[model samples]
Target: MTYAFGDTDLAARRLALLAETFAPSSRTFMVEAAHTGLRLAADLGCGPGYSTHLLAGALEPAHTVGLDNSESFLDLARATASDKVSFCCHDITTGPFPSGPYDLLFSRFELTHLQHPEAVIELWGRQLAVGGRLLMEEVEYIGTTHPVFTSYLEIQQAMLTEQGNSLYIGPVLDAVPDPAALKRRSSNVQTAPIPAERAAAMFRMNLGVWRHNDFVRRTLDPSDLDDLESALAAIESGRSAVSSVEWGLRRVVMDRVDP
Candidate 1:
């Protein structure tokens, strides 16, 4: 699948290919304790309706809003929006987030995609009601310490800096726990490796990012586009020694501490 923008949903689909995808230490991370009692809930950037389905299932007793910027994605959500759930196509970066004193708000592997993740987090925080919970699970690529992945990451870092951009994922993960410049919000941040199976799947799903990151396309292999695709595939293989070492994945759970 192409990761350009609608990649989150594509990645989510690839993750649930197996039955155990969301089984705790599995390919997906979702709360199963039942959210039916929540007065309101939302899964912002609920691409492809994967998480939308999960949220709707859990919040069956309440109205759940699925907000996203892609109409193609919202269409997928509406197909499953029976009665307690509905999809809203919107560019949350601007305009209003649907009305919510929502008791719970979440996004899986979602926040890091924004150029202004901090600002976006602040916005979501604003929509949260008293005693509400805002949780975001993101890729917190802590280190390039893996023996093989370090090279690719180093190259990525330099390439992004040259393009006047940062690597964007891990750094933001580190910042979520600190709400210093954000709107009045108290939060907690935690990180852990997603299951190897799921991690590899998500990375593999976005196999095209190497070409989209500008740094990889313009600097890493500017003269060898074909070689770049080959490398991306290799790194996503999970089993290939070189790929396993080069592509690593993890998730962060950021929660807006309930008052």
Candidate 2:
């Protein structure tokens, strides 16, 4: 499952597939994001609009912006985008983010991709409005119940690295980004429960969710395809599925205190 810079299209396709797998959990994730009252939210590295769609309808804000560098994704995003929302395609790290002081700077699985997710966090924090919150959903590979899923994931990950891709931080959450600076305002984290029947799909779904730079397809290999099929079958039968095995998700919410 080695990835190459040339395979962006394939990577996008694979992530789109994975997004379909985790589509089941979108509602729960969205509900929590909305309840947080993220009025001026920014979906950084928004892939195929998974959480963006959820956020747009969930928040009653005047505007929500979906940001990403992928032309493929922005096209789909624009088509699926609500009239209340907007889209932008640009390299987030290099390009300036749309003017902010945003009520919410939210991103799922986007931070970990950065060589320094923490640094990115610091930058995003600067964009927060007074009383704004940053809700980040990140995945770390702890382990898996299904042998095929775990092995397949490791292989895929190794392949991605070989292709010069840097992954989001490993699932060891505490190391991700410390909230010591953020705690003053108020911060908390929780893990989303994954049902066993959905395990295989869940793990693969997490890996596949990035959809960043058409990541999955570039990393895909014959073996990876086999793993995906097997996991999908297991999930369909409500049996041991190839999900995020041992790794747990770390959701960190940092809010700016209104002084």
Candidate 3:
């Protein structure tokens, strides 16, 4: 399994953005979906555990498990472990789920990386207890008028396609076993403005992540990547002035039906 953007500094920076700009809305959506009586919850692809921690606070699951395939990320999650929250190392696609019949199973931006997301969803659905809910959040599209970000996204999309993954996996949610069980709770295009310095750092980190990848080199124009790198450095060094760096993100939330 090739995770083009694995657990790295770039992933961490992106996680920060998700934590600050995305998770609140997602938590609110899930909370409204199941107002009370949420007992156990699992966060698939929990990464460094931001969403897992958030789920713990929002649902107060009696036992919350943050599952991921990366031991490095699991180590980071375990460091912040609490009585109610724990970390598990397991890939959601093929590995055995830790223990389920859970009150909630949640994942974000994870489906896009998998070749068989529907299969994973079916397996996770079986783990839900009666009346339990499955919630997922994924990017429908990333829109940006910023040239640098747009160019970066283009390359990113190509890289994902090369890896047999889709950066836009929103429509695949419909392929779940019971189409009626998936509810499209929210869909919108919004832009989160990041400080120029922080945005520059994020771009640099991602470029670093992709720079060494053979697929990236073979699939994208080398000169363009170099130009983007230089452009980001200029943006960071005050050679260029950007009023605000924006990320146009679209997200959809799906809820599993009660059985």
What's the residue-level lDDT of 235 in candidate 2? Answer: 70
Which residue runs does candidate 2 get wrong by more than 4 Å? 1-38, 160-173, 176-181, 184-247, 257-259
Q: What C-alpha lDDT does candidate 1 achieve relative to the native structure? A: 0.54
Q: All candidates' lDDT scores?
A: 0.54, 0.59, 0.73
Please give, for residues 161-190, the per-residue lDDT of candidate 1 as tens digits: 554445546546555544432232322334
Q: Write the per-residue lDDT of candidate 2 for residues 65-89, one digit (tens) a residue.
A: 8888778778777887776788887
TM-score for each predicted model, relative to the true structure: 0.66, 0.69, 0.83
Order the numbered candidates by lDDT, best leading.
3, 2, 1
Residue 237, model 1: Cα distance from true site in angstroms: 6.8
Model 2 clashes, total count: 19
- The Cα error of candidate 2 at residue 10, in Å, is 5.6
**Candidate 1: which stretches are off by over 4 Å?**
1-36, 59-61, 142-201, 209-215, 222-259
Q: List the residue pairs that clash in candidate 3.
A: none
